[model samples]
Target: MLATMPAAPSDINVLILDDNQFDRVRIRRMFESLEFGFHLSEVENLDGLDQNLDNKDFDIVLIDYNLPQGDGLEALERIQKHERNCNATTVMIAGDDQSQIAVRALKSGCQDYIAKGTLSTHRLRSLVLSVIDAAQASPTNTDDLHERLELLVSRVKEHHSSALQPKVAMIIQDIRSLRARVYQPHSPLAVELAAVEKRCLNLWSSLSETDAITLKAPKDVRVS
Candidate 1:
């Protein structure tokens, strides 16, 4: 059975990178046959892919592992370098049934991988929907989990006053615990965990704003 697409507005944007014109068209046709709506931009080279990615963001990016420059994995690496493209679902297309390629791609940050030779509309739909669903559920998918969290922690230290270091440390703890329960969302524990994380974020924001106000305040000047 074909997977049902989520309740999304009009056609979702998609970017496909393949040096082969035939493969690009084949993939586009598969998407066309699906019940789900999609607006696709096809690129035949890394330069084209970079150009499209630079100008706009896509809902998903499909990468073919064979290219004149490097490969699909290389393309994925380049995409990872751009923070705006971080949320876009990325999938690797392999020419043959190579499990190794799929394993490596997944570890390196792709949402999923598929063998192009055996690609069908059903498989494509299912794979695409599954990754999209997972991404929607896991906010951690914004970027590498540890990397994103570290960036936030650094910001907290920068704008926040030194006196609140203890509270900041506690918030950091809550964030770590939040990470553990992040994927296992659903229970009351998860609900509370999310709340705790929200509070932590708000605390940081409020602290930064307070500090800014203090710095901008004028001191009372008395005539000596």
Candidate 2:
């Protein structure tokens, strides 16, 4: 019997890198079919990958070992460097079931490795959970800072439309003060949270100002 796995983390975001159009589509479909709660993003080339990394944050990265410009190892190296301050987990996806390549990927900082043809939703879910657990358990100073910012954002949203104008004003002041500290080079966690703040603000701005608020209990949201 196959081993059972826990549910996927609903808050985690995933980034997929694959040059082959067919493979990219198939992998995306698999993630979608699982019905797991994951935010999926994709890139077909190194340039695209860089741009995506700069614009949005991800919880995990799934990179195909054999990309166009260089092998997966090179890409992984670049990712590690670019994401040095990030806590995202990196997993190398390979077309060939090569033990040597898997070993090398691990040595090069990949959290895990999977063969594309044998990939399954259950396995993916498990890997993602493990990565998240690890990150939370031993977060860097930067990670802690981001967590604090997230809590602040959540609290602000909870009272965002309330009649308590003073509370909302205080929250806004707190956010602005935190934003100043976030730009310091020594504050990796603050910097990461700053980026997240910008993204969230952009998304919020895109939505209409008048909208009914509904509190729905969290449910498993997955993608294939």
Candidate 3:
């Protein structure tokens, strides 16, 4: 039983994959109270999840541990294959306290996790801001940044699409080294990136709010 949530004003795009109607409703209600404008799309099973990820990239992806049709961890593992969606910040939501699942998710690359019972409007909002901040923050080292840049360049060259924005396919096709851009203030993708960031900041003024054994952050990034 797969379904897509109706569209909303999109300050950020989020894709949520979970099978339970009640839990999905709860998650949606949390977003409704937030000031930020977000477009959310939900899918109940693995096929739906893969179909959505294949066509569009989400800024954040939240995955529930139990699914009617498949394991959330297994789905997370497969998401790595999506070159663009692979970089989306991911978080895991579990129905119960499961340290092993949490650890495994972290090791696999998820940025954060929380028990479903513990979720609250305030907590959800805080986590959203923090993770988005972390995603925008520059890498801790040059090599890490360089590696990302090279990866982006190569991926875009092969696919003729940007991992950052599906719409801005060739945005960074001719990107200069990030090392130079660090001192320069703007890169080729500056305009688009700035717009995305400015929206995040504005959403903060308004207020608001996945996984991947499949997608991992760089080694130096330690989520608090």
Candidate 4:
């Protein structure tokens, strides 16, 4: 099941490295929804990552910019030093605050940067398809994909400011509204959207919750 791809002649093998189990699960779910015969391998630490790269023949690698072991740059460096995986296509999954880091990776030979918050099922599939298509069409030319990914990086950099928190709040509200509409009463989309909405709501609740330490401080205590 992991090595067979019936949709295309050349099966795509993907390796994902992230420290968060929730993120790993989310990415796996998104990939499973693509309905393509792709093999996926995941690792949570640098050791596992190095071991996988050494043992498996992967076509692409998706690395989280911030990991417990080290950052995505360290992962990229390892990939570069690997004798067999040196030329493997790599993408960085970055937070909104990390556009500059992503840009640095892109300049250092990463294929693309995907903002963590923007990774929905549709976006994930589109990105994978674009990368795979580009890789196959002209293994040397990535101009189109590079231009588009640069645009995404620019957008992230543009939004990296004090206003980002409010913007995120607005986006979550929009998602909630959209989910409510799609999840009317009892439908499959509704069921799925309900789960999505719950996740968003939980995140919102966390954001809105007052800090426990703050609550216990003296009246004169300043949060700043």
Question: What lDDT would candidate 4 get against the real structure?
Answer: 0.74
Question: Ten consecutive residues with minimal summed lDDT in candidate 1?
Answer: 215-224
**lDDT (Cα, tens digit) per residue for candidate 3, span 1-224:** 11233233336678888988888888888876776667889999999988999888787888998988778788788777788798777788986767688888989888788788788777667766765566557465889989999778555444432222322222222232323355546664665555654553443222211111222323332222
User: What is the C-alpha lDDT profile of model 2 across 24-126, one tens digit per residue?
Assistant: 7877776666565668888888888888888887888888888788778887877778843255788898866587889999988788999876788777767
lDDT per residue for candidate 4 within 54-89, as digits (tens), equals 898888899998888678999998998899898788
lDDT of each: 0.75, 0.69, 0.67, 0.74
Q: Report the lDDT tens digits of candidate 1 across residue range 128-191.
A: 6765676566755546877889778667666665557456546657565666866766777777
TM-score (C-alpha) between model 2 and the true structure? 0.56
The local lDDT score (0 to 100) that residue 66 gets in candidate 3 is: 90
Best by lDDT: 1
lDDT of 3: 0.67
- Ranked candidates, highest lDDT first: 1, 4, 2, 3
Model 3 segments beyond 4 Å from truth? Answer: 1-10, 138-224
Instruction: List all candidate RMSDs to the true structure.
Output: 15.3, 18.4, 22.2, 23.4
Clashing residue pairs in candidate 3 (N, C-alpha, C atoms within 3 angstroms): 62-210, 90-210, 91-210
TM-score of each: 0.57, 0.56, 0.56, 0.56
How big is the positional error of residue 77 in model 1, measured in Å on the Cα after superposition? Answer: 0.4
Quote the positional error of residue 72 for candidate 3 in Å. Answer: 1.2
